[model samples]
Target: MPQSETGTDTAEPVTDHDAQAATDADTDGSSENGSVVPWTSITKPTDDTETLAAMTAASAAEPGADDMADASLPLDQVFAVLKNERRRRVLGMLKQTDDKLSLSDLAERIAALENDKPIEQLTSSERKCVYVGLYQCHLPKMDSMDVIEFNKSRGTVARAANTDAVYDYLETAAPGAEPDWYRYSTILSVGGAAALGTALLVDPMTPLPVIDGTVGCLVIVFVAYGLGAFVWTHRAD
Candidate 1:
């Protein structure tokens, strides 16, 4: 470089980048003309391919949905928690009560339903089994999702704000209101009887070509049994 007539060394030519750098340095983060400056500018969205572009576009479009990502449990997590029947029942119980529950109390209620007995009739083993499962597996998983606030120190449980998301898909019977498996057993027994009767009561009169006994007996038994079951099931109502 050579000195100019003004006695200062010849200065480098000013460029657009130099002016921009000087502008940034003067305001720190404030923009020129007193406008607000963005902390980040997307100069190269193509760096990350379409992912960054799509995300940036979405974020810019839906400013109000910023919290939507965290609004509910993720699908994989929700499905994992929902996969277990016991976990679903736990949510149902919490939704029904809508308050904190002692571990022992919760276990007793679940055990009673599981055993199809009253709370007073639940055995120690049944209660213990339910308690252990909740404590060891289910409770931890739900706590991770923050669906239930589980205080491990106090052994207490309460519904969390995010519980509603998971609870919406859950359906379960409260304690003392389980389905009657015995009724299903009756259907199985009747079907076996009907098949046995069909085998025994071979109707040679209608057995011209294809088959043996008449299906009328089977149909009659099913209709009669269905009526009886309907009556029995609705006895309380």
Candidate 2:
């Protein structure tokens, strides 16, 4: 209205307005980018769900096992086999006196004589040494091509080198000797006989019906026989 000659009026300066608009836009952009703080400077939460779940999973996982282990079978036989070691040092120690070695003593001796260096370095070496003796020393030798005639029940023992042509044929056909079938059969037979004997003894003293005691004893005997048969015929693959 005042500068009518140019048909315009210079009401306000653009510099201040433009600067204010830029400052507001920058504030909004900074908020959009999360924050003005550097990435490394930000504080992470202590109880993140993903991290907690990962930690729990790791805690729950079972530890890995060592590969050099043998199948755990009859404890006494396994113990005997493991007792046969390089130079039979362990066996000799046991034979010097019929003393059962404590875990600590066994570990110390085995660590002193172990073939594997990593095994020797173990601080709690007893467990490892026992494992080696049982699996590596005993089982393989027992399973080998050599003919070993050992009585599990009587503790009778003998060994002979494989020279027979028929021995080769047997080994080739069976791979391993058909696992001590006679021993298992004998065990089952003894159990069955015992059950029958118990049933007879109890039947005389038992009350009302003869059928209950008879049937129970029969069940027990049958179960024992079944278990024995399974133990004998089954081979670990």
**Candidate of highest TM-score:** 1
Q: lDDT for model 2, please.
A: 0.48
For candidate 1, write residues 56-101 as lDDT tens digits. Answer: 8997887453245346678778777877767777887787785688
Model 2: pairs clashing at backbone N, Cα or C within 3 Å: none
Highest lDDT against the true fold, candidate: 1
Per-residue C-alpha lDDT of model 2 across residues 1-237, encoded as one tens digit per residue: 355767776688669889868666645334456554344345566778898899989966845331112222334544344333332443344444443444345445656444334545656545565645644444246545232333334333233232121122222223234445455557767876676677767777877555566667767876877786676544321
| Candidate 2 C-alpha RMSD relative to the actual structure | 21.0
lDDT score, candidate 1, position 114: 68
Q: Rate the local accuracy (lDDT) of all candidates.
A: 0.73, 0.48
> Can you give the TM-score per candidate against the true fold?
0.50, 0.20
RMSD, every candidate, angstroms: 15.0, 21.0
